[model samples]
Target: MIPLQRISVSTRTQTLLTRWTKHVQDTGATTKAARAQWKKAKAPKAKVRTALESMARGAVRCMYCDDNRATDIDHFEPLDEAPLRAFVWLNHLLACSYCNSNVKRSQYPVDADGACLLVDPTAEDPADHLELLLKSGRYTAVSGSAKGEETIRVFALNRPDLVKGRMDAFSRACSNMRDWHQLCQEADPEADRVAQALLDSPFIDVVHAMTRLKPSVAAVVVGPRTVPALDAWRSAHGF
Candidate 1:
């Protein structure tokens, strides 16, 4: 998961959410009340869903899984824990149905110090906590990052199909990089198109990991011959 920017919703929509929050609080701040109110907003109104999608990753991918299309507005902090923040924009995350309901559910882990152990993509960069293994399509928690471990566990980030997607994305990215580099060398008119295609590709984090590759990277998916293409691609994209 990458860090996301929360763009503002329409002023009228914001007012509606604010009013909903107050309405829920007035009803004793119960979980049932929060769910009922959110159901009304999410189903019929849909302003929150649209706003969250606008803040999502490429092609409106889930903020947690980053694979499937996001269709749910997840409460990063579970509704039971922070009932008052139910309609708060800051707590909302765009997520897929699987990640929002099946995977995460209501599992909210906190460290002994009472600090949240889940990575909030809008609040923190996932790179600081998690390291993606491009070749194997797995993630390792960075040293001293419990949040990364929990996030991986909660979202099932290393699931087989998803891992395959990342692995496949690596190969495609390498091919695209070679093509992009060739275009750059020739000053082809199609270079911009190729560049935009890369930006729109799935498993964008893999593309990101490729750009972050350095001499210290001992086990990358690509081999020695592709290093120059990778470097050239990085330069072409100003990475």
Candidate 2:
């Protein structure tokens, strides 16, 4: 998961959600009841989900996995803990069924300090807490951050299929970059097209891994590191 800029919902929708939340609160209903109400009243609305999918790169990928097609709206804060935010636009994220139903499924673990342990892609830059293992396409938590550990556990971010998917994407991206480099060596104008394709690839994290430049949030966690292969690749491209 990467950080995503959440889009604003229509004012009419926000007002309706506020009123609905207030009504649910007034009833003194159980979390389960509130969730049921949210599903009944809001889950079927396509416009809100369309907006979220728009945020997930025009519906091609899940906001969580960044690999699968987004098929559901995942509540960043599970309704069991923060039911009031159930219909709030910022709390919603596009997710795949595997990440949403099979893995996360209402599991919101918190640390002993009572702080949420899971990563909220909209609120946190995931790279700050998580690192990608390029060789295996698996994820590891930064030593001091429980957020990454918990998120990996809850989302099964290292599940074999997902790892394989990431590895495949990384391989494809590397191949394209190499081809682009070859084109440049031959003084071919097509090098630009190849470079553009790399930029446009859905597996953007691959490029991020190959470059030293990273989101500021990541710098705070990992500091600076020298990966010889990546550094060599970047230098060859004069990047």
Candidate 3:
């Protein structure tokens, strides 16, 4: 999981959200009412659009699967059951609509400790609990706990199509890097020219995989000296 840079909400958006939250708090509004307020306030649409654009900018990739086209707002906690958190900025995330609706539905934390399993793209590193199966392109929880298992199952990380997509992205990224390296090997090719070529053709997965493999590649190609800087680029834009 990459640390997401929290974009400050515009004053107008913040005002709308605050008013909507107050309405919910005062009236104990039904979910539909809350949703209507969100729509009327025009905060949700803007927030959703901003979140999607942020995901596209960085290789934030999907939490469930590595698909790059995340276009919906996902609640780390189910908004229906945990309505109090609905407007929480940190709880909001960009998701592919399919993963948010089909697999995640109303599934939420079962107990205080059970909450640990939910992936927080902005807080936790996904690599800690989850690993990609190179052969099958599936995701599995290395830590065998209820939260981990439930998270994996709920997100459908093992979906064949999603796995294939991740693998395909990884393969393309590797191939690009290999090609770049081969080009560099050519007799005294211009370093500035090579760097410019990489900068021009930005592939999210390829850049991320390259960083993981060799920080020097990042330093040479992207000029990030620390992990935080690398993460900043990844969270803001994936490739």
lDDT string for model 3 (148-167, tens) is 56667877777777667656
The per-prediction tally of clashing pairs is 0, 0, 8
Candidate 3 structure, TM-score to reference: 0.70
Question: Could you tell me which residue pairs clash in candidate 1?
Answer: none
Better of 1 and 2 by TM-score: 1
Worst 10 residues of 2 by lDDT: 221-230
lDDT of each: 0.82, 0.72, 0.57
Tell me the tens digit of each residue's lDDT in model 1 across 64-171.
877888888889889988887889888888888999999899889999998999989888888899999888989889998888999999999998888999999989
Off by over 4 Å in 1: 42-45, 218-221, 236-239
TM-score winner:
1
Q: Model 2, 193: alpha-carbon shift in Å?
A: 6.8
lDDT of 1 at 197: 85
lDDT of 1 at 115: 92
Give Cα distance to truth, residue 170, candidate 1, Å. 0.8
The best candidate in terms of lDDT = 1
How high is each candidate's TM-score? Answer: 0.91, 0.77, 0.70
Q: Which regions of candidate 3 are displaced past 4 Å?
A: 1-3, 8-12, 55-63, 112-116, 184-239
Candidate 1, residue 37: how far the Cα is off, in Å: 0.5
